[model samples]
Target: MSSPTRVYVSRLAGLPVYAPNGDQVGKVRDVVAMLRQGTQPPRVLGLVVEAFARRRIFVPMTRVTSVDIGHVITTGLVNVRRFEQRTTEVLVLAEMLDRTVTVVDSETTAVVFDMAMEQWRTRDWVLSKVAVREGAKRFRRRGQSHVLDWAEVSGFAQVEEGQGATHILAAFESMRPADLAAVLHDLSSKRRNEIAAALNDERLADVLEELPEDDQVEILAGLDTERAADVLEEMSPDDAADLIAELPTDTAERLLTLMEPDEAEDVRRLLTYEERTAGGLMTSEPVILPADATVADALANVRNAELSPALAAMIYVVRPPLETPTGRFIGAGHIQRLLREPPSELVSAVLDTDLDGLRPDDSLQAVAKYLATYNLVSAPVLDDEGRLIGAVTVDDVLDHLLPEDWREPDKPEEDHHAS
Candidate 1:
């Protein structure tokens, strides 16, 4: 069956994208379009697909074979390179939704809510229709809604100052923090700041941790000092520390002072370590339980949704003071061993006490080798007094080991041909 010639872009968001052989590739996050001169409609370039590991990749329009209500099918060949927006390109859902434009006929201003792309020729798609609503006047419960030809709308070509991100946030409400960070990274600085400001503290913190340092610093700078401190409090202690280190010393101290005492202490402690050391990369808050904790208790601790898989993979056993810089470290218990043991069994019985713990001054290379040698996803770091201070996860190590620009999109390799 042939797919429809025209489809609303909003309906396409979140739809699963599949390969020709019926393999699911990813989900459609946004559509890429190139704006043309004057009133001509923008050419639909491709779809921004969130592939495995939350990597956003571009699926050129020519490679898409079908765009049905249930799913989008592709020609099986997908470029694995991360999608980096060109200056001439715009993301439809992210940049267009909720834009105020003048209705040519009425000369009245209306907010765009949705856009429709139509296939004008073989393999050629363009935005042809816009759905907008006029602002409701006093005494009116709702404003009038209209569907108009793309030509009837003005302001699509002009970048408006102080745009709101309500609709853009609504469209991507369900996206994970990492994916949302990518979306924000591709947007203009002003637009990105607007979206960041719209997000609640916790959501913004999660997204901030995933963004590059420059973006993180920029977004944090845009927020008021109090709000920035609150956002920092919501982030993982290690990540918050890393970000704070990037700011001017005075600015960093001010934010720390505004943060809750307990949270501020953790960040302060992390800042004392060298950047490429185990203490620098390890998270201050890992699942730490006393030796008396039962296997069931360990299981419960690892089940917390906020924990990354690597951190949850192992439970650190301590003598007392469950927080980081805890009392004498006893050992570590892998989640796998906990599951195999009787629920009533004490974690102490299954603890891997023989494993050596990392020190604050241990080099990143040393930490990586320790995990690789033991095939561990996470390992505990102990203080000079032999107390559990933190746990270094594999993900953190990889982040530092990769090139400084690892997060930024790279030029597609020769093998990943666009056609």
Candidate 2:
């Protein structure tokens, strides 16, 4: 009599499946290879399951009747429920916040799939010549399956890393979609959102900023009003103004109605200026302290508000009669100079009399020169009445003037495998 057939994942393709009652079930999609502990054909972990009536399922190897390429024959539809549940829900690559994964051959030990990860991880990529001997080859082939071997690769590992981390990198780079998305998180919001929009939404999102303003407007117009409004509401004020200004007035008005009152007001105010002005690009959320407050009080507010010294710019003293006839307000030097002193120190002592000011209508070129002349990261924008309506940071200035939308280019690519 013929000996019982032995099965392997590589050889499984179109195997026939059957139900518990012996009725022919469906065709085998593939042999699902699983990562195994040391020394056993990865435990015949799973199979590339298919069904006649439902979508494909990853039937465990335990229930598999045979696994021959083109034929991953299996028995039992009853026990595949646990894992099948995941397949039903949308899987976002961004949601794998805590699943450990390995990436291989890059500037970072984590494979250089995305530029941001490479920069953030900051580890070297390591590679070695593979010497697959007869005995060694069996373990690589038998119990554990290697995804992409450097030996099989045509290019070099750009950076080097520790031996163990290197191995991990290799394993993750070649992992399956279900398993890969099981990890690959811990990236930034922009990175994660890009991955989500590409993957499953797990719920949905995207960044239209990278695209041209025209493209951003074009795409937003196509989305349902609700979703388009969400994208607009989510955008930075500068980006929002740039986009909404490009839209037809009716479209812009419709979206404005849907946005939060304050945020909508901010966008409307920003859009009022020409796209190339301090008033057009400045963020209105500058941290302003009343002039009478002590340095300590200001420091406390700074910490509590989480205002960046660089972003908030110089704190203005709004007390009575230092300069204004109305005893209105006057500005001072940057906080970095006074922060070393105790917070209890008086504000009058820290105020800088020789501060520069910009009117709302000042051109971006004028603002850029003023900031560069003073080596300033941020400058306060005062209304005609001398009220600080907003503040401009170097980043905001650069982001507006610069041709491209600037984000970390090293960030990971959008995940396309979630659903």
Tens-digit per-residue lDDT, 1-419, candidate 1: 26898999988988999998999999999999998988888999999998887777889988988999889999998887777777788889988997999999878888988899999866699999999988765664466999999889899878788777777787788888988898788788988998999999999999998999999999999999999999999999999999999999999999999999999999999999999999999899999999889999999999999899999999999977888889999999999888999999999999999987999999999999999999999999999899999999999999999999887655655432255
Candidate 2 lDDT at 119 equals 8
**Whole-model lDDT, model 1:** 0.90
What C-alpha RMSD separates each model from the true structure?
2.8, 21.0
lDDT of 2 by residue, 1-419 (tens): 01124322222334467665666656544332322233212122344343532334556544654433443345554343212322222111122111222333322112211111000122211121121111123234422323333333221212122111222223233333323322222233333333333332111222464444544555565467876777666666666778888889998999999988877888898888876788887766655666667887766655643354466556666644332211345775467866877777877677776765776788889889889988888887777777666677787677767756233222323221211
lDDT of 1 at 192: 92
- The count of backbone overlaps in candidate 1 is 0
- Model 2 CA deviation exceeding 4 Å by range: 1-224, 227-236, 304-309, 319-328, 404-419
Q: TM-score, each model?
A: 0.90, 0.46
What TM-score does prediction 2 earn?
0.46
lDDT of each: 0.90, 0.49
